[model samples]
Every structure is written in C-alpha cells, then in structure tokens.
Target: MTAITINFNNVVKLNVDQFYQLCRDNPDVKFERNQLGEIIIMPPTGGETGKCNASMIADFVIWNRQTKLAEVFDSSTCFKLPNGSDRSPDVSWIKLERWNVLKPEQREKFPPIAPDFVLELMSSSDSLSETQAKMQEYVNAGVKLGWLIDRKTRRVEIYRQGQPKEILEFPTSLCGEDILPGFVLDLQIIWN
Candidate 1:
C-alpha cells in the first residue's frame, strides 16, 4: 500500500467510537488522526512488503505465551479509540479480568477500551514526538503500561501508571515488570 493515500476533505471530526463505526461501514478504508484532528488514510495492503514488524511481534507473543504470559494481539487488527482515532500499535494486550467484562458483541469488535498494555514499534516514517503523544493518550485513557520500541536506536521507553517513564538502551533487555511479571523481551532479537 502507498501509505495514507486517502483525501480526508470535509470529513467532520469523529469521536473514537464513531470512528470505529465509520471503518466498519467503509471496509475499504483506514483512518487515523492526531489530537489536532488531522486525518489520514492508507490503501489496503497487498502484502508487497513481504513481512513487517508486526510479524516479529507475533514471534514475541508466542514466546511470551510459552512463558505463561497471555499476550493477545500483534497488529493483526487496528483499534478505534474514542477520539476518532484508529491506530495499529505493534502489539497490545488486556488482562483477563478486565477483558472479560465486555459483552459478547463488544468483544467481537474489540471495543475502544484501553488495553492493559500497548507497544508501538517506531517505523522510519514515524515521528518520535507524535508516537510519544500517542503513548501518552493510551496512558491517560487508562492503559496500565506502554512501550515505545525504537528498533533504529535499539532502545525501549517504558511507561507505567502513576510513575515516571523509563528508557532502556541497546545491549539491554526489556522487562514486563509489574505488567506481565517476570516476562522479558530480549531487545537483540527484536532488532535482528
């Protein structure tokens, strides 16, 4: 896909939940916006890039599962937030109890509920400040933990509730800490 090719002219601002419905109504399109209301869309992928970072996230999830951690998603789908935003983070997960509260129907669509944890893999086209702002939104929206993974610098920024963010540089490992308890992601494999 030729990234964000949609012309978002005259599309009034939409809230997160409403945005989700828009996507469902228009399956051929994708949407995303910043807090300032700049909307963008991209063409559906034809799989021309072979594999992306999302695939590596799958590998990581499998590894997490083997260690008894239930990691649910790896960019398999995008999430619609209440702020008229649709984002496909590198990976995201919810704790069992909180996820169980969803009605069967809501569960199917994976409602705009905040994830217990979210991970964003920084792509070359992504801006650092913008990504950080997105992470902040997740945190403010009730996400318990978030990670901004930068493969270029091989560093990871860990964001936790009610605490200052922590950054881990290359040659180091990233831990789930309180979020997944004992789960560790070896940064070397992620960049490889």
Candidate 2:
C-alpha cells in the first residue's frame, strides 16, 4: 500500500453521539476520534490508517475476529489513555469478559472503556519514538497487552506489566503469551 494524503477539508464534524448513530446506520464504515472534538466522521474511502499497512495486518486481525480472540477497531476511536491523553491505536482489542460487563445501554455509547490489547502498525507518517510513546501511554492506562508492529523492520515490540518491552524479529512466532493462551499469530503467514 502507498501513502496517500488525507483530505480533511471536506470531512464532516460530528458530536460523539451523532458519530455513534452514523456507525449504527452504516455498519460497513468505521470512524475515529477527532484530535480536538470527541468524534470524527468515517470517510467512505480509504482512511490513512487503512492504507498505511499491508493486508497481512488485516489477515492477522481477521483471524482473531473469526476466532473471537478480539474485535478489530481501527483509527475510529478516542480512548482515554493514561495521563488524561486521548489517542486511538491502529488496532485494539477488548477482552470478551470486560466487554461483556457493559450493559446493552452502555454499549450504545462507545462502551465507555479502554481496550485490553492494542496493536500499533507503523506507518510512514509515524516515527518510532512516537509509536513507543503511544505504547507506554497504553500501558500506563492499564492495558494488559500491547504490540508495536514495525513494518519497516518486521519486528513486534511486546509490552506487559512489570516487564521490559521485548522485541521479536522475523522467523519467529507471535503468540498470545498467556494473554490469550493457545492463540498463535504466525508472522510468516502475514510477513510473507
């Protein structure tokens, strides 16, 4: 995939509630949180987050989605990271148990929580330092697991509680590592 400049000049500004309604009406499109406001309308075409990486990321996410390991959320969210900062991950997951805690009414309003796991796929516009900072922010926010996938290096940086960020390079497997035991993400399949 190639990097394309996103044109936000025509992008519609919407309230969080209106954005939720929009997603409910059009299940095909996804949205992201606005840097200033609480919401941003999802474009009908390619969003930067989508065009940044290859389908391998999608393949891994699709596999998880099919197995119910977790759900995939693109740049269409404004989760409150630690330190009162709000940022959206490239891909994020909510544990079934935590997600189930939400009442049907609560789910109507963005689930009102942070994700259990986050995956940040590196892009041309994002620097390594920026991604690392985002990972630390997620960890500080109490996220259980986080993966910083560097497409340039084809390496994954793993973050967990009380542990150093571990880097795994190619020819190795990306596993749940007790987080979602028995689940394996074969990097070979995606990195191929």
Structure candidate 2, residue pairs in collision: 31-76, 32-76
lDDT of 2 by residue, 1-192 (tens): 332223343576555567568667877655444334443333342344355444545755776767786666665555644344445676677777777887887665565667887777776556688569768868877888888877668788999877889988763667776665566665654354
- Please give the RMSD of candidate 2 to the true structure: 5.9
Off by over 4 Å in 2: 1-70, 189-192
Among residues 3 or more apart in sequence or in different chains, the pairs in candidate 1 whose N, CA or C atoms overlap within 3 Å are 4-41, 15-84, 16-81, 16-82, 16-83, 16-84
Choose the strongest candidate by lDDT.
Answer: 1
Model 1, runs deviating above 4 Å: 1-11, 15-18, 25-29, 35-38, 42-55, 63-71, 80-84
**lDDT score of residue 9 within candidate 2:** 34
Q: Could you tell me the lDDT of residue 88 within candidate 2?
A: 66
Clashes of 1: 6
lDDT of 1 by residue, 1-192 (tens): 244524444667665566667767887766665545565664443331214454656656776677654447755466555554566666787776766777777766745567788888776666688778889887877779898987778778888898888887775667777887776766655666
Question: lDDT values of the candidates?
Answer: 0.68, 0.64
* TM-score quality measure for candidate 1: 0.76
